[model samples]
Target: MPRHVAIIMDGNGRWAKQRHLPRAMGHRRGVEAVREIVRAAGDMGLEALTLYAFSSENWKRPAQEVGDLMGLLKHFIVADIDEFVENGVRLKVIGRYRELAPDIVALIDDAVARTSENSRTTLAVALNYGAQDELVRATSAIAARVAEGSLAPADIDTDAFADALDTADMPPLDLLIRTSGEQRLSNFLLWQCAYAELWFTDTLWPDFSRAHFAQALAEYAARERRFGGR
Candidate 1:
């Protein structure tokens, strides 16, 4: 099985619109899908599952929508943290997540601390995340170290650069799945998924189930990874 997998949960609003429901309803349903997928990932023995929860660019969305998203995030943490601890799933947040609302940040910190010791699986959520922003931050840190004479310019290799990323401690990405028929990365995990297999499905985020997830894994198993070698 692929050790690490990440997903771009798209089409929540579209799903709601299609059903003549409010966007918030779609997001709520999407959270339910998140719960199911996290459990499936742990049951399948995946080392890590990273979810693109919110991107830095998402701030441009309507204020009400953004607020609702934050509320859902808080609710998800409060509601699901116990299960995470019980199931041995470690909670991790990537990107500039600390920039979120103070209360939300506090909740995330508490949840992360509460589940820090779990070893079975890592659930990494990307909040306020953007691959380009992540890369810039990582590069800036590396440059600062070089300026301080603590690191040499010649030492900046792929491994060194990767170590500066927010996902440095997580397993290498082995597969990346995007739902809602979206075929683009949308600025998610550009660095980590460099060699990961890509999978896209028309199923919307709220409609994504364990069966769809299983199909992706089965397809992954049948493929050969060349990793730049024949």
Candidate 2:
């Protein structure tokens, strides 16, 4: 079974356009999909699930859309906290969290703390995160340690760098699913998904159902991952 599944949620705007609904409504519906997937993942006994909620490039979107997303996240934070606790999902946020609005950031912290004791599954939300940004941040932190004389440059490698990133504590990713028929990575998990099996589907984010999730899982199980070696 795929223990850790990472998702690149795509095609919300397209979904809205297809329905003649405003883009904001699409985001709202996507929240429902998020809810369903989390429950489905819990039922499936997934050890960890990481979602690419917002990427660095997402900031370039229209101001109104961005504001709507923030509002939705705030609502989600409040609405899901209890559900997370009840379902034994440990909530964790990974990325440039300081970039979020102060209130939203506080809510994220509160939810994480409240669900910290849960042991069923770890739900990691990647907000304001970009793969290249993560790499740069990790490299800078490591370099600073070397400058302070506590770390040696020669002693640093993949293990040292991995510990500096936000998802350091998590296990290697097994499967990654991107909806909306998107075949490109779009700079999601640069380091952690080094060997993960990729599954892409045309279903929009709001339309991604439990069966869609199952299909992705099945696809992942069929792949023969060589991890860069034959």
lDDT agreement with native, every candidate: 0.97, 0.92
Worst 10 residues of 1 by lDDT: 221-230
All candidates: TM-score? 0.99, 0.97
* Deviation (Å) of 141 in candidate 2: 1.2
> Best-fitting candidate, measured by TM-score?
1
Per residue, candidate 1 scores C-alpha lDDT tens digits across 1-230 of 99999999999999999999999999999999999999999999999999999999999999999999999999999999999999999999999999998999999999999999999999999999999999999999999999999999999999999999999999899999999998999999999988999999999999999999999999999999999887
Candidate with top lDDT is 1
199: Cα error in model 2, Å: 0.6
- Among residues 3 or more apart in sequence or in different chains, the pairs in candidate 1 whose N, CA or C atoms overlap within 3 Å are none
* Model 2 misplaced stretches (Cα beyond 4 Å): none
TM-score of 2: 0.97
